[model samples]
Target: MFRVFKTCHLFKQNKIFTRRMAAVNLKSLSEDKIYEFLNSFDTVLTDCDGVLWMDMTPIENSPEVMNKFHDHGRQTFYITNNSTKTREEFLAKCSKLNFHATKNNILCTSYLAACYLQDLGFKKKVYVVGSEGVSKELEQVGIDHCGVGPDTIKPGVPYKTFERDPDVGAVIVGFDEHFSYPKLLKAASYLSDENVHFVGTNTDERFPMDGNIVVPGTGSLVRCVETCAERKAVIVGKPDTYISKAIIKRFNINPKRTLMIGDRCNTDILLGTRCGFQTLLVLSGVTSLTEVNTWKQSNSQDELDLLPDYYVDKLGDLLPYLEKFKPTNASATMLKFFSKSLRVSMAHMLANKENYERFATQRSNNSLLAVTYSLSYIRIDSKLCNQSHVTSANPSIIVPIRPDITEYEFLFTGNHTMAASNLKSLSEEELKRFVNSFDVVLSDCDGVLWVENEPIPGSPEVVRRLKLIGKKFFYVTNNNTKTRAEFLEKCEKLQYQAKLEEMMCTSYLVAAYLKEKKFNKKVYIVGKEAIGKELNAVGIEYIGLGPDPLVGDSLGMIENFNPDPDVGAVVVGFDDQISYPKIAKAATYVQNPDVHFIGTNCDNQRPSPNSNIFPGSGCMLRVIEAAANRKAVLLGKPEPYISQTIISKYGLNPERTLMIGDKGDTDILLGKRCGFKTLLVLSGVTSLKDLEKWKRSEDKEERDLVPDYYTDKLSDLLPMLSNS
Candidate 1:
């Protein structure tokens, strides 16, 4: 028998449980409905500990259910609030329990603690009031830390006698077996200076109570420090959304299709709800049905966030439906909060609370209908489009709705929906008109045309369609790793027609810059064969092509490195075989002050198809700049050099051109600077969240990175092109 709490009489007798939440019970569903529900999600983000097992013991059939979920082509991630265990430790635990796991699949607060400090560019030592887990994570990021070992209680000594480390910049609190008055005093003393960062692993008040034993969790220690320090700490665990932000940033998660499963309401369910992920509550842990009923009767907004969209007796309950499921592309009707045209649809559907209550109360099919935030909107599934006009509502409050899209799936970073009173998204007519206005299309090759070595789905067809429509096409790339000939071959392999004159590469532009200046000297190159080939093609002499051999010193003296007299410039690009000798040689050449320094591009990371990021040319260029104490003239996108080359050589008009790429900082900013329209596609590196960062930033350079328009993928535009 399922647990039932009749807290119905605790509140106003008129209110009911269904009014607060209509969570669907999977056990009540038919086999077909169960299959459909199971197949709806592509990813499952489950809370560790209670949901999977209790301490070290595995929950019955939970591991089997997880393996089954993975078998059905669904991605599974273990999200946990426990900060006492490092990711490696957690992975070991998962392995011991026979659970399928990987390092990338886990997001624990201990790891988040280290990531937080790293993001802040912290170089100082961390004073930890936790375990080896937090210290291990900090060590992994090359962050020095202290205060990990047991601090034995000294009953007679005063707290003021303890000396604090001057280098400590942050105090971290987690589960500690040796937490005492001395340690607490040390943490509080460090935090007395308000400038010091205070990070708490989580705020979980208590651990799951073993009968007759109530063990205090990490929060108890954190609260002790908070009380003594009289300062609030930034929580790095779930329900705070810091971990969620980091996870989404690392893996481009589509919230709409992602399912967050957990056993607790406050942390697990609330996080999923706050992040706009579909939530499922299991009844095997901390929260009981009685607490849910109490919250429902209270009618608290915060309480409402804790409610789950669906609930089950246990996670293993869905195991039977795994093999029988058939995934489909269909989606539920979505209400677009930011689109102004939605007002018309709002009038037709149920409006106001009274109307919604009547419609909701009439339904008794046991199927849950989760009516989330935004009351002034009606339900309709539609695609988002760009609009030129700004409405009275804050433009940042945009919430796009498509049958297949969700708030999480939107992938842009921003606060929760700020009720759009008068905002607008473009209509179908506006989109068609927008597409027809562009006469020439200039696209970034790495992210826009192809990802890694493979072409993005439907991209080649889009290029062919644009060519068929008489739109002049050009492939622009900041990847100096590949020569123009290599890029041309890649285009041809992907069925994209190309010409030598129509392509603009950083290496080619560097060659052009050298040729135009009539440099009659050799270059100290810190790049690959691609740059060498381009330079050789333009009749420019160069050295430092292959690995620069290290010079050995027999005595206790430094090896005297000298630059060739003929070297008049230092050129850097993406070199997989870069070495200290090469950097020393390049730096030695550029330090002459007469020698010019030119970098191919400044892209930080190269995007890969399998979602891995490799450090790009910018890293090498920065190394040379730091060593030489001078900046290089960057010649790629967003820099005027490449744009100058294309305009001067091809006579391309900026007014009729459209720049497309997956990177906003380069492709979008370049378009804005060159007076051309820009479109950001999600098929590559740049996520909707990354674009939103630049949109919200107060810096002009950041604001300039915003794209004129965006699409989920490049293929999304194919239908519009066909219609046009």
Candidate 2:
């Protein structure tokens, strides 16, 4: 809520460190609570046209704030969200405005969308539907333009007639007031076609125009066309995907390091929150002092869905106050707690003001040095895939592309037994024959099946096509935690078919091995309760792992097998709550070689949305492996019995089957050792870099760990199957 007092509280409260604590238990507070909150945000996003100056004239303290950012090396940017101007034009304007913004720092609406479209392999006639300024912006991006000539729309007609092309793959909708009904109808007809993509420049119902409040903006025009076509277009303007991505790329700043600044709470802050950037709101522009709903009961609070990390009358005035700000030791946790209490996203102080002012700080409007999408959700083709797992190491060996690879030169390497990579170079019949030869189809889980819970591009379609063509396939994975049913349910959610009889998992074989041992004594489990549940179904007694009462009297399991010297094996699985005490006990128990020690699987880690990687079952295995200088038996994928468990369960002819996955160490090696064919697709973990590194390795196992075949993705498989 704004206070509209004409900056009357322009004076700082003396004894600011004595500000009342929301939490009373704290002994010392931040140096300056106001400065502390402001420090939470590291970057600022200011609009060029209005806030900087009403179209051009410098507003008060504009240069002061610019100089502050320059002096402190703080991340500051002038985001116009203006589609009318290109990057060069925006930089030129910044130069004219005396901010000295560069082409790399400033972001325009149309340019980002253009770059994304090119990246996405969209080749189509860009039908322009905006003013001459917007048309010029499109021309700067190398777009093959074909659309209505530059003119104002007729008084009654909201659009102009441009001859529609059936081959037009995309229609870029922008602001056009001098419109006609005929143009509107034609655009609607083309946009409604399923193949043609519809992209809007912006959704602002009105923008600052020649000193007048005009209703003629992209939002209103887009609504008219969308209403006519009964569809919504992908908005690519300010506070949208384009500008957010632009800020990411221009700043080279990770989402964690960037912040979005604006005056309007709904449009400005919400974009930052949703785009994974921190947000700051100044009580300067759209939302004024008292109009905000405070009770939290109204629809507007939920509807607007925006809140700033810090609230202030103006953004520029923040610098002068932060010099005296203090901080507490536990301020980090307090910050998250305070944000949750106030229903805001998390943020914290970035750097000291003097540090920013001394060593860095440039005055150009382009404070952002690097930019890109925080989350680049690319929908790639399926094939050579596995469960969604992240890599622990970053690439250090840089492979510079040179004359080694060129179009129509190389194909059918040692791994390309099916000659599928040569499809591009082959004739229609040759491609058909090659596809027909692929009787076996293998699939991975992560990028090909689903990145976590979401399925990859055409996953369902690829599976359906494989099924139709009577291609025998298998879902192979290295993650050995959950049993067969869990993996099947995941597949079902991704709209893929799975038979319980056809299921395979690493945990199943481990459970069977434990049952075979027939140890009559209590088995101390380190993994999930599900493993215990499986063990208990076979009349085995197992105590809980956590701080539950059941584990209270289970100390003797750590000592030598006392009860008739037949204590069962110590089974370790992926336990989310295994404590250090339990590990210390297990380490002591496994000292006797007579007592069998078993672990579920040896996966290094698992992926989660959390900041740190969850140490998987492999961490537990490593602890035991170090204690007993002998390798424990592995019963997971890439292992024989892991695949055999599914075969025994389904009673499938194992010799005729194939294993499909991306990782060479797990998928290809396992399939080759088991007398099964392996198929690799480039949709998941293993990339061209991995292939090059592995293929060039001197190790014998590494040299032999090649897939029988490889393809760019699984979607390519379906087209080949159809042609065959």
Candidate 3:
């Protein structure tokens, strides 16, 4: 929310200063201030869905307030993040609801997406992972597209056998109730090509619906595609500035005088803030007053931008306020209010003993002073008292008349929390202390020691040095593509000394888990030969190791399909030859209450150095889960199974154990979940940008991803070790 202020005189010892008020309640303002506010803006941009109407129902007197805007000759535009409807459809809905909207006034994401592509002169067809609204808008702009309706997995046709359309040059993602496994596969496959443009309609996580039922929105589908594709899409809706650009291009309006109204803060209010528009938040939708207050106290500038200039219970509440201010008498009301001498009685009263004590008592909780004077208010945050002077007469009263103090000096203060740790900058003594503090080291294989088949520079030397220092090292990996022995061989080839007993691969873990359960039934596999080899090494019987391609139609395959009566567990890992038939078979077997479902890991995609994305086992696992309507028992990093096994087997103290990896979601999160100290190396999946985001995130899950220590790479530790 942008900070907005009406000019107010601050008379202190014949000195004056201007200050802004933010997140104010409009109804609390005096009649003159309200009249001034009404006359301030000529253009009004309001969000639909939650502000004007919810679904098909109009919010109380909202239509009256909007229609009044038209009566007063204020230009109105309906802006929405909803991508499910075209501009024509939106205009019709407006007409039906009596909001007095024209087709030109509607700015939905679907229309904006069309405008974006049209402006780019894109000629090729679009492969859409969305609804008909997106496709219809594209068609209106003379752009060809496909993949609008349901695209279910064909019985006889393997997913890999589906040919790529040569004409597809872009992939647009929006709201789609028909989102399925086949659509995900197609979108991911199309996005594999570097030339294909990916555009998402909006990033709204869910709809603002009342009741216990939660409706997932387009953002969920967009993120799913982004994960599987390993590419960030160009967002075309709120908080992206695309729609703002569209509005600016079409209308000649002053941003300073424009009023942007909405219910959601991240999207609607953020958009207004970015465009320098006055923002009004209504509590009839997603964001609440508690959230706004929380954001106000946040140290992050990103979260601060979500604050609105003013808020109300709902948009309809403004109708009564609007009724009081008529165009004929608005000027007279403002003039009459300004003609009177500004009062210092409120400030003078604060100087008295009884009044000061009462004021201090009221503000004791938050240490904040808010004094309302006439039509304006003054807020003095006691937290910013480092440089300011306190009056001798009253020690609690802050003197605001200092010659050097700027108007905004009291408002903006720097008070930051200390960072956890940065390993690269640690002194030699500190480094030695850190090394001696930990007895056991749990290191991720892929990102920490190596990326793919290549070892990271100096990683082997660091491992050798750590081992020489008597640190118990364990190669913890989520990679199920290789057996423990095979992983040990790779470690040896990479010049890192490791034993088979120290290698903790997911494949071996799965086999060990089933073996410990003492089950005699065969295992159904949806992975490569490594899982099969691991099971065989454990003297366990299994089937479905290699590719099981779909050969015929669904009805024919159903008649021929035979469920293995002896199969008691389904193990899923990385399979390069993963097909529709494999997923179908796995889903079918897992549907039975008796059959166990296990997944190697939930790592979305393998970290790649280039544009090409390698879909991880999690992608296959999700596809099978979606088809089966059941969750897999995951066995990997971030899950306590492997960590518990390591702790129990070695009898190691968790407080003295260190977990080091490059992925925050898996490795760092696992360390946090357990009692291990975490060190994040920015050599693989997680980067400095990701670290900063997690550090500032309001979500506890995102904050949990922050590691205790971080460095550019694991190789940087070699210098510290050598010095120590």
> Evaluated with TM-score, which candidate comes out highest?
3
Ranking by TM-score: 3, 1, 2
Give the TM-scores of the predictions, in the order they appear.
Answer: 0.46, 0.40, 0.56
- Scored against the true structure, residue 162 in model 1 reaches a CA lDDT of 63
Report the lDDT tens digits of candidate 1 across residue range 107-215.
Answer: 8989999999999999999999998899999999999999986664444664345666789999999877555445655786788778899999987655553342234
For model 2, the local distance difference test gives 0.54
| Model 3, global lDDT | 0.77
- Candidate 2 structure, TM-score to reference: 0.40
Which residue window of length 10 is worst by lDDT in model 3?
12-21
lDDT of each: 0.71, 0.54, 0.77
Of the candidates numbered 1 and 3, which has the greater TM-score value?
3
